[model samples]
Target: MSKFFIFLFVIFIHHLSLAQSVQLTGSVISGTEKLPSASIQLKIFGNEDLFTYGFSDEEGNYKLSCEISQSDKFLLIAAYIGYQRDTLIVSRTDLLKQAIFQHNFNLKEDKKQLDEIYIKAPNAVEVNNDTTKYNVLRFTSPEDRNLESVLKKMPGMEVNKDGTIFFKGKKISKVLLEGDDLTGEGYKAITKNLKPEFVEEVQALEHYVEDNLLKGIINSDDIVLNLKIKDKGVKKIVGSIDAGLGTNQRRMLSTNLISFINRTKAFAFANHNNLSSS
Candidate 1:
């Protein structure tokens, strides 16, 4: 009889502990659109330390479970790239009232306006009307070899496996190098070969019109990307040459040269390789 009573007591304690655990579920959204891969954080109301962290699933749903009963109050923070962060506070009374809580966060799109005269505005992201400009130098890292690599780090931008670029879930029509369409639809010629250091700004043009005269007159929803080459990098030739000799008398040589002078853009590529030994 005593053993049976002890077993029942253990079961009761386990159940009580489970009841005290708090589970929070919600969706992080931006204007009715679900935001996936959003960051979620939990912290005590008065403490600076983080209690737990999690990320939203592909459907923008997040679930957080924590032993928050001991805490008088706690805070939940939800954040996504290019969007404003949202926060919610829960008191102990709220937790005691319900073990499973439902809360949703609606994050707004973040738009920034920066002045060029600002002293510390080097890394600023600015949005004006329908265009967004990203300071390439700020996002460029030593590991980034080409413009494509730097584009991947910008918000709302994606580079497909086939070298295609997209912004805001829409495919861009063309890529302009120094205000000129060099490759039309095939932009890989510039994005893949041009080094990141030579580019100063990347402008994302929405509702792009190919002709300037018909920009506002024509109803177009095409997106375009414009690369602004650095002043120092222009009017000068830049490229590399590679030559290698392998075993069995195999040899390979390749060279790339690029220059932009007075509205004239030039690019030259040459490769000579031997498939078999002579």
Candidate 2:
């Protein structure tokens, strides 16, 4: 009898967990035309990467399942080839209480060229939902190679040599490139290698420690940073090699190769012999 009761308790807990999952159904379309295939993401408040992924079928319909807890905040981001990415924020205290949600997305075509009419782009700071954004091209000069230089121009932001990013005298949690942490490494990898020319925008998330929902529950005070990179649609291989020979039979060689292809980025290094690196 006791064993039977334990089995029933386990089944009940499994059902309870399943009941907490949010079932999301949506479609991706472009101006009344359904996109045959599309990609979607659920972006959590504080984390750099999306919480989950969904793919649209030939009918442009997609379904997603994710776990949601009380006070958790998130947004739906959808993307398609040759189209601009779209984001929809779903944060209603009452609506979140439900176990399922239905949402749809519309992606705009990525127009390559614009009309000859002179129209200025937004080159200033703007705030959207929970994110504060700055267009790097509009705020800084062309000669800047690293983001640290431009970040200094933003008010209440401080960049230190020790890879510390401070906003309002408070250190932030993480930094993202192209909506994802391409490299698990933190700010140093980005501020040093990413050039200003490729950056589309710099986004700062306010008060999103451990993904907003958890932060609210735990009373955290960490911020988040995101960098949006433009897709140039070009693949190229770039690298350099150096070889040296000295008097005391000393030799040095260093080679580094970097590749940025479609949807993939890779870096490889080859080192021969012991060389003093400072």
Candidate 3:
């Protein structure tokens, strides 16, 4: 009878596992319109652990499957490059049978207004401190090139051999594409991976932060790099490929591709290196 008991035990465990699995489905929309290519990240509540992440399809639809216990809670964070972040809370009680939960998100635009000051333009504004702003158009020419090469030529901006960026004297910790923080080793990934052709302008904001109370609170100075992208509807493809041969029979090749269709954007990249010796 031990053999019979073992078979029943295995079936019970299988059924319990299936009961704990949950499927989440939703649609993302912006101002009554579909928001394709939206980024969806799922994480367990109060923890840094990420369960699963994926992007929205052309129809602004996304689905994620996750394993859960009786007491587990989840947080869903949705973000698009230019749109504000949207967050939702999900608990074990929300999962009932195999059902489709529809969620439509409306994103808002970031806007700013400047106050008019009664002051005339001085003949020469004293710039004792080092300050610089790089217009993306200055670096990007008709000839397509990678972001690395373009950043090297930007005024007052320096890209080191190790792929770190130095502005004035402070290192850039974050690189934003139209105001969205790239997050997690931000500048390192952006300068190394993004293409120059996609950039419309590079804005350098010194002493950056959302709250003024926190400004200068920390001793270290901060600089923010903002990359304004071209309009998606006007430009479909923006990226480039680079290959070179050097002395001692050395070879290098790299390719980056970025394409945008309406609200959906796609990015892909590849690289190869070879060396020859006698």
Q: Rank the candidates by TM-score, best first.
A: 1, 2, 3
Q: 50-157, model 1: which lDDT tens digit per residue?
A: 666666776889898877646678788887655678888877668667868888899987765123223334333555677878888666778997789999877557
TM-score per candidate, in order? 0.53, 0.41, 0.39
CA shift at 78, candidate 1, in angstroms?
7.4
Scored by lDDT, model 3 comes in at: 0.63
Whole-model lDDT values for every prediction: 0.76, 0.65, 0.63
Q: Which structure is stronger by lDDT: 1 or 3?
A: 1
Off by over 4 Å in 2: 1-120, 209-220, 232-278
Q: Which 10 successive residues of model 3 have the least lDDT summed?
A: 116-125
Error of 1 at 38 (Å): 14
The candidate 1 region of ten consecutive residues with least summed lDDT is 113-122
Question: Of the candidates shown, which would achieve the greatest TM-score relative to the real structure?
Answer: 1
Clash count per candidate: 0, 0, 0
- Residues 1-278 of candidate 2 have per-residue lDDT tens digits of 99999999999987765446677887899879987546667766666234666467668898888666543567777866456888877763533567668778888777752221113253245545456677776546667746778887664466777867876456777777555555553666666655566667888887665453575576546577887766534585455566888767777876554456886665455556545652
